[model samples]
Target: MLALRDSTQYAHMTPAHPCDSDDPERRFRPLSPVETCVDTCGLARDSAPYFSQHNKRYGVLTMANGKQATARRLKMADRAQQLQDLHFPGMPEILLWHRNRHDGFITIPRTLPIVMQAVDAQSKGQPAGHTLFCLWARSPDHPVLSIENPSTFAAEAGFIGERAVDTWRRRMKKLRELHCIETKPGASGEFHYVLLHNPNAVMEWMHSVGLVRAELYSRFIERLADVGAFGEIEAVRQLWAQQQAAEAASAAAQTAATVPAAEADATAQANAAPEASAKVQIALPELGANL
Candidate 1:
């Protein structure tokens, strides 16, 4: 597994958010379940390669026909528009969208690969399993998944179910409704979408949605430090402070430069007035005596 290094603290880390505990109904709602075998378990042959190809090529999978593709795309768009109306009407707009023709799925902007795994529990003569789809963007600095075999996928399933699956579903749905997922055609008649947000974008979007205070963005960065994502939160803090100071200095310089030249001319005239008067008196005395 590729770990994220905290740039500030030099510690291994992961991104985390506050877990919602208040609404049990909302929280436990049947999340988009990962199909063990699409349409039927055990009866359906493992189409892992098909899904893999879809994921690698288009980032999302969808039905092969153009009409169904168009309908799914429209449905996704409608959902996104609704989300935008509900939250994030502005800022960090969706960037790209793509889907695989072989499967009926779409990847939202900024989503990562959905890691599918066999669950420890078996389902009806078939291996019970689920997919761990990443709803949020990982820090680009972190390592992407390194699953080489099905066992690794199984291990990851545990990791994700415990840490990410629920959160992923919630956030993914929210993002989808917000139109944050961009849509486009893929090589094999599939579609692909890239999330528009990076780390900064996530911070901004969080603030936009009232999930966290603007001031908390810094603290969240610090927490990332605590989790070993960066070397130290203090270092990130210092960097941010330094950048602010530099910006302030630049703004001050620009303001100084923008001061009107006429103001400088006025000051110079005021300072020279007494000398000019004295010179005028001497010249006048000389002129009077001559006249």
Candidate 2:
């Protein structure tokens, strides 16, 4: 049972005794729930009964029908009462809501949708995006829907049809031209788009194209990092550390070069002061003698 109240006062209100669905209509805002998986997954949801080897936080749950399922968040207060009560015995607030996974193929990455629907989450090889994307890829039976195949990517991602694929592919070409992505030749004469790895560069590019906001861009990058995307995050951090070290070394060298010049200038000033004083004394005595 879910309930709703004023957003400001929602925290103070006591939980109603299992009220009917009192949640109101959603505000006029588009929704995104999925996230790009990280290398490490946190504790599993209270509702889920199983766990995945890779995603230690939660295993893909087995439903009544024995179909392995993943978690999807509800737009409304799926578990508001639990959080509001402050007495609910369960996992942390982050894993409060235990809802069904959204069923569909997604073209966009996780952290955007927060919803995924699939039979098996682990198949083919893992990639940097959603650990779920591993399951979302083209299976033999589901071959028609994979992103690698264009048509599937279009449909699942909200594109129209085969025609949409050509348009999107063309758009990808334009994006490639802009250097947002790189298109490399793959087997079977197909082209694969390698996403740019730099989060700052990606954010700037997305903003320039009106695709993301500061908040969403940050969230997107965070989720991408979670799922081991952009290669290894540790590796990226290492590179950043190395760059900082190089810059520090350069600054130190520059300071060292200036120190010698500064010392020489000081020494020259001290020597010149005695010579000037002696000349002034000698000139004054000669003028006195002549007078």
TM-score of 2: 0.30
lDDT (10s digit) by residue, model 2, range 31-142: 2212222323432211111112222322111122112112223312546665666756665756644334444443444432322211011111311223223323432333
Candidates in order have lDDT scores of 0.37, 0.40
Candidate 1 steric clashes: 40
Off by over 4 Å in 1: 1-226, 230-232, 265-291
Minimum summed lDDT over a 10-residue window in model 1 is located at 111-120
TM-score of 1: 0.24
Model 2: per-residue Cα lDDT at residue 105: 40
**Which prediction has the highest lDDT against the true structure?**
2
TM-score of each candidate structure, all chains considered together: 0.24, 0.30
**What would you estimate as the lDDT of candidate 2?**
0.40
Encode model 1's per-residue lDDT on 1-291: one tens digit a residue.
112222323122221111222332222222111113343222211123333333344332221233544565578778987987788665443443334324344333221111011111212232222222332222133223222233333344343446443433343334433333333334422112334333333333443455443334434433332233332323444576799999999999888876866689888999999999999999998999999
